[model samples]
Target: MNKSPGFILTQLGLDKDKVEKLVKALDPKTLQIAITDDFGSSFVLSTLSANIASIVETNVVLQHEKDGDLGNGWLETNYAGSRAFVLRSWKPNESDVLEANLTFWRGAPSIKRVVIRHVPEPATQRLLLEKGDVDMARNLSADQIAGLAGNKDTVVESSPKAEVYYDGLNQKHERLRNPKVRQALRWLVDYQGTTESFLEGRFKVHQAFWPSGFAGSSTETPFRLDVAKAKALLAEASYPNGFEVSLDASNFYPSIDVAQSVQATMAQSGIEVNIVPGEQKQVITKYRVRNHPMVFLYRSADYLDPHSNADTFTRNPDNSDKAKSRPLAWRNGREIPQFTEKTDAAARERDPAKRLQMYLELQKIVQENSPFVIVFQVQDQPARRANVKGFVTGPFADQIFYLLVQKRGSRDRGLAQPGSPILAGPDPGIRAVACDAPRASDPRHPRAHFLRAARGRLRDRPGGTDRPRPRDRG
Candidate 1:
């Protein structure tokens, strides 16, 4: 298993000897694994359920082996699981057609076929949805969503995603290294203003690393656009006249708008923010190397556990350039040894309540003092035909499932009143036409079909530009 190029032993947080002793295959269908560390049950269990741990058909994988290693062809070219839908056809940068898996163990999905079309333009998606050419539109701007307010033919569903948008103050910059400066920057953000304006219906004011709808999430938005307070803090930090710094941001919708809004607000406190707009990859690449003065970016959890975010946002185990694990804290050149210790302790707390408290405490510390000024949490708002029933959108893109989705006839479409819940109980045998954002280059699981569709449409752009779109993981 370790011969694969994608294999990473460090991801398990164990050395070779420990891994050999802890993992064993007892039978063809059963694998026994044990963690020697005092990790929380929730954290450990969550890791086991993550996409990386998904079981694959060993024989099918071995069939595509090359150079004594299993290649990545299974990710997109082969199907091995008994999922509800199987990829019938996939056209790059275009669409995917999934046929129902009749032999699925859980029972065949009521919908016979699921067709996902890649429609990048929100207006085109909206027009198609409105014309009944498509049953669902996964990408729509806040204004577009607002325009459909009273449309009885459609229902808008909003799900709070785990992604959080924040501004990272590069500690490599002398002015941004000060705690008071970090706090000052926090006060300079017009959270409500942005949330109500360009960010409306898409993001909500959030101040912590852990997003809401999770166990350890903090709902306290303590800092607002307090220019006077920010100025006082900056003055106390020996910068009577705020220092000039470059703020790198993705040159895209909402990000550019957000950067401009932040630029305007920071000016009120004497902080001269020179907006450096670039492609999302350019901005992220610069931030990843700790080369930016400040960066506006977003991060999503790899898994559902609180530590998924805490580990990245708070912990910086190594500060040197040679460090192998460089999370968000390292990306901003922030050394947080104390918070890292607390985060480790939180991850080890097996008691659910104690672990929750530990995470909460950690969040409070980061919220008040860290270089990261977490501003907002994403809210996914997808508009679907009023008759589209049983469609589900979860906190993460991978969690979205269309197994039970059904497209009722036009006669039944009028049965749904305006603003009524669109996600209803399942009715048998109907086809669904879903318009999604873009497509992920490497799709991992069969269930990830709709996820890739939703994720592609929401997170990335076509033609491999790497520009930041409206939503999804970092």
Candidate 2:
């Protein structure tokens, strides 16, 4: 699980009565108030410090909602907001609908709206980007990005991601319990060769779990494939003839290929590896439960900080209350008090220099003793149409900064026509051309119902029934 510090929720013009009504209907534990203002104007919602680590886990925020069931009735799909965009209703396993707010809290979003289609296959995603059906192709392979080089309308953006792909061992297994045996297996992996061949020179051989430029990263190249060294270590650990172990991986492209490559390499050292492939969700479940003896997976840090990586990978709840679990690299329930102490101190440290030292020390310690075979750091390639401005790929695969994106000619062409592009040219006295007026029931104005409902709730003043006129948002 990756953890971060940036997600926020605020009241968006909902009346006191509606807020209270929604709060009463929802579970108390969904969001606890750490502190309410003395003026009764605002409150800080807390994630109950204990389970803070789990916040980074996938879908933790949306896990409570059931099929076609949003938790609160009064809390309808549309909540009035001044954010760049408000989320409209969505179909499960389909698409996310967002509509722009001209009077956004920060400023009006450049583009009127965005609809993200769910495209799982890379081939189809690439085709969409090439054919101009989609504006961007995320997580595209190097080859795919290269294929779009000749397309004048498209451009590929490449960045070094704070991620690593590795094979983790469940230390609870008797054969892998010994540090020597685990170290031996690490040597059996051809990390450098895989980066050069499979990754096509795009990725770098990362020795430690942390990304190269981070505070807790190392410049050491300790483990390399040496058949003699692997054999010696295996024999020393009482497995001279090698032992067979099942290597499980998600049926994804590079992951399966990596597992197969490792199988061939480890075979030379007498470590018979049976490659087992399954769906990503099922494979992760097996890894999380410590059922898989070995797992080949790709995991990225949730945040830019070293604490995010260290807290999730090194510290366990038993030793450090801050962490709940470290399922990716199972440690056989081994509690290292010293490791926990250092990690906790680093997390609380305010001095940047001292904090850096603490994190670097932890990385070195974990690298020497942990049950992980660190492979390589990820290099991401995301392609977008040249007209799709203000979008960049962050370390996280799913990070979307759509509000910042604007089509190059959006200003002159005004609002875009859904089924077509906004056209612009070198014509004299060019002026913004507004599209056909939208209908009241258009999805873009999802909160139209809420606005109407609020209007109907007129209250009786001393003289007469008083109602509020809609504010001129423009």
Off by over 4 Å in 1: 1-31, 410-474
| Candidate 1: tens digits of C-alpha lDDT, residues 295-391 | 8988877677788888898899999999988899999898888889988988888898889888888889889888889999998887988778888
State every prediction's TM-score relative to the real structure.
0.82, 0.68
lDDT of 2 by residue, 1-474 (tens): 111232212112223334444334235235333223221111121112111121111122234345634322212332322345555544333555555655444676777556666565667777877766667766566566667778898887767777877778776688987888888887888887887675753577876767886555776768888888989999999999999999999886678888888999999989999989998888888776667888888767755667656765676646332345553433334466667767767766756677767778877876777877778888766677778878654555434456688776432111111110001111100111112222335555535643444455643222211222323111
Tell me the alpha-carbon RMSD of every candidate.
10.4, 12.8
Local distance difference test values of all predictions, in order: 0.73, 0.60
Q: Identify the leading candidate in terms of TM-score.
A: 1
In model 1, the worst 10-residue window by lDDT is 412-421
Colliding pairs, model 1: 437-457, 438-456, 438-457
